[model samples]
Target: MGVEWVKKSFLVILMMLLAFTMSACGNTSKAVQKTEDGKVIVDFWYALGGNLGEAVTQMVDEFNASQDKVHVNAVYQGSYEESLTQLRQLAGTSNAPAVVQVFEVGTKYMIESGYIEPMQTFIDKDKFDLSQLEENILSYYKVDGKLYSMPFNTSNAIMVYNKDMFKQAGLDPENPPRTFSEVSAAAKKIRSHFGTNVHGFSVVTHGWFTEQMIANQGGLYVDNNNGRSGEPTATSINGEEGQRWFKWLHEMKQDGTLGDYGRAWDDHRAAFLGETVAMYLDSTASLAGTVTNAEFEVGTAFLPTADGMDPQGVIVGGASIWMMTDIPKETQNAAWEFIKFTAKPEVQAKWAANTGYFPITKAAYDQDVLKDRYNEYPQFLTAVQQLQNTSVTPATQGALIGVFPEAREKVVNAVESIHGGADPIEAINKAAEEINAELENYKRVNQK
Candidate 1:
């Protein structure tokens, strides 16, 4: 609870907008910058708050402390949406930072912006080995099959359970729930034994939770050609599998087991830590923060599934470092240096250790320090194991279309319908229709 803990440097940043259709910032698309003071002042916009901001700053401080030529000043911009808005105001303005942290969902926008440098060329010229990063992690930043952003700390959802609750329910905590059937069974047992004192399971479906469920069911949330492939003019989200996931949520809600809508990952954790929710599934990054303060012994498991299907690949989460194209070459180069430096193994392993995000570099995962982490906290290994075993399935990778935030909100509005007595299938079908219409509109407006 110390101030340092508040700023501890490597926390996963979540900018939950509740509703996705916020007015986006006016395009900061291509501007130029001039240099001053012989010290290139590289503007760095970070989305992390508290100690996580401190962690990013810790590295920024190191970069600054290491040399006098480039002065990287770190700016904390509230959340991803807020940072994008700030960038909008600073766009074409001299105050714009050279580097801004962008969430994965914004990848398509940044690539189309043409305002940032492509990372592939940067690596080839700088002799930065792109091969050092695992194939699974590297796919998150690519556009048109070329790298644009450097993969930083990455994570995926992991199943979390209250061990005491599981134990009271006569469930084996060590084994945990591997598939959806087991999850249903476990929930029933917990409810049967602990009554309403404990929960069988709960998942806050905002942000990428819906997509994660799609991936969990071995289904794709969006097609490769964006939403175009799923249907000529619709989405495939209300398919049998997607409905199954929603049905599970609906059942949980009806059984007095599920939690609320609009409860973000952090809010759910706050609830989980408060002992209100017995089981939760969320980002791997949640472990370190929650474990540090958890009063009960928490258990971790691979995200569950149904019947014969394996746990589908998990989608990548966590922010990436974005370079503004308008910044002076010196500042841009300096920003690249910092990005490349952070991608190094030592720093990555340290980041992984500090935050639950899996290291982007294999070296970090193989590092002695990180290897010891698994030994120290077996529960922490779930995501690491899951991500290692994972693949870049279209479902897990996510959809790429403009007005992404808007589309995500439409999905939520469908989710909200379930509480209002609407059928899950009907609600999802309505959501896909809305998404397809918006998708076409976005494509039309942002046409190249």
Candidate 2:
């Protein structure tokens, strides 16, 4: 062949090879297996890393080794938001994974997408006993008397404080603040005792904290019973509860009792670890890392409510496992098997002990491993007790708005505005109205 023909031929061959590789690689969560062992392949996409990822990898390896009929390929896709984005793009495609983990805020959107098989389908088809699951944890994902996904890793917000700082401030560490007013008082005391370098408390201007505060005060987040009775027509954040929360935060800031960390979750965490702040409200999911990094004795307590308002309950936070629809029966069955395995008390306990995410089921606590772990580190029990004490009210079940993530961002902006000395009532009202408009669009699109 001539030189020109030879070069063209090489280019053609290279293109073909690249195509083959791309086809074999499949989606972000799936890759072709090397072995032809007659075992079905099940791809699982998860959104955890670090120690939590290691714990999940162990579970997957154990599950794969336990069965010859199925093989699970676990893929770590960045954050929960990234995983959900990939899921939305891959749905109904041949390259889609068999299972995906989506964050709590994405729940309504996932349901509206109509791409996933309701976990209740498999549960009913297989007669899976759900009694072992924690009712409070399960309540958040259930809608219209059905669960669309499996509760894999559930958590809630709590107060994390430095007990040593408490003692130095002459405040009882065991009696951590139970309400927003108490938090303010404690913060003032700690700041006075520790001086200007150390703040009394710190909080990120995140929307989840806003949601949790409203729920704890037995207030609704959105209309239609926090979206349990029907689709939410509007959000309820501009009401009495929102005013109280933002006003308290403003007052705290004015008095140097609370540190402004803006929207960086880690900044507040670092504040806690560096002892820049004596206490802060954060996720129960943060227990393991907080305990490990803090030099002083770290303490845990239920997240504080507004003054004179006892905590009715806090909503479940964290993500859950969702199975995609229209996949092969064999692959779907295998995925369900892996999911069911993870739900087992043994696996749940292992996950809880390792990652500090609350186990989804009550039975997990009955496991000897978890019991021993809890006994060894009693801080874990605080979240467990909080979940147990939560009432099964619609508000506590969490708001299921289709535009939840957007609504949260709007709330965050409102918080920032309030921190900058804007009127709390005006900021909250503007956010609520804007979120209501978004909800209207969502309703039109979803036909709800």
Candidate 3:
């Protein structure tokens, strides 16, 4: 009986050992992998969707094919907010991606997050020529005289209008409105000519538009030079510049010429395409798609400024590529190599043509691919010219607030409130107070 019990126990122990070995083998197979040729693997998390996402995947394929030293695994992580949320959870972990794409407004948060390796480190180490890139785009990513990330997919707001509607309204199709008053006048004329069938002008209930309007008038969004010189203690959106923007919206709303499409970009674009709205503000990144999709002849122009204010320029509104610190050193270097490839003029030209984003490298303009694209879509020149014509002041450099996403939400609420007949001054003031409180809370939590 004792011998029989010993044999059974031995069999059980052998079975447990076999199961453990198989589990260990499965985990090893699931671990991060390298190419058969020993190329370093890089995991890249991106937020763009639809065509933009496809373009990113294409670029990654090209980059992998161009080099044998590195292989990048591109993964779609959903919307910018969703992807950032995922990163927040996975950051500082072995599962974290070697590279991540973060939106422009997340700059301050990223700088304070301690999860990234500033692009400046790689730039300095490799002596990369930042002068080769667009200064206006770079200005937005630079903090305290250091570039934190590499600019990719950069865009600015522009006014897109239907030339057919403009001519019908007795307005010059060649020359679009350049100021708030001009836009209002044009909008009223279009509405009057179309007679209840169409509205004059519409802007998406987005905070980015408000930021652009204020910046165009050389107005700061926050104190301390838009928070670049120092941490901002308060928002300046309640100032004269901001008031002018709000008042313009209020007047437009009162006139019934400003279409209320809510905040969905698709809704606003649909209104324009459906000819329910004559003109609207949209990102330059949408230029190609808008022109291709519009049934009428489309015209592109610079964003309107407040009357009597010279255009300070629109801030670049897009995402940049950030390197993660939790990645292995070899992987980081591989990621940097991929980043440098993305910045190449040829690559930038292809990306710009495919995505309608401004090529970060100025030399991309000299590339035949980009030149051909510009020639084919002449409307694309307006955005590039607008960006080139902008003065790199603190206002145009854009605001840097740790709570910028929250602040933008407040501004959006204020715009909606004003559109809903709330007093513009009161709404603006309330939004400002809310943003200031958020900034204070952020500083308190992040104080070091």
lDDT, each prediction: 0.74, 0.86, 0.92
Off by over 4 Å in 1: 1-37, 225-233
Q: Show where candidate 3 strays beyond 4 Å.
A: 1-33
- TM-score of every candidate relative to the true structure: 0.87, 0.91, 0.92
Worst lDDT run of 10 residues, candidate 1, spans 18-27
TM-score of 2: 0.91
User: Which candidate, 1 or 2, has the higher lDDT?
Assistant: 2
Error of 3 at 416 (Å): 0.8
lDDT of 3: 0.92
Q: Which candidate do you rate higher for TM-score, 1 or 3?
A: 3
Report the poorest 10 consecutive residues by lDDT, candidate 2.
26-35
Clashes of 1: 10
lDDT of 2 at 284: 82
What is the alpha-carbon lDDT of model 1 when measured against the actual structure?
0.74
Candidate 1 TM-score versus the reference: 0.87
TM-score, candidate 3, is 0.92
Clashes by residue pair, model 1: 6-50, 6-51, 7-50, 7-51, 8-51, 9-51, 9-55, 43-97, 179-305, 180-305
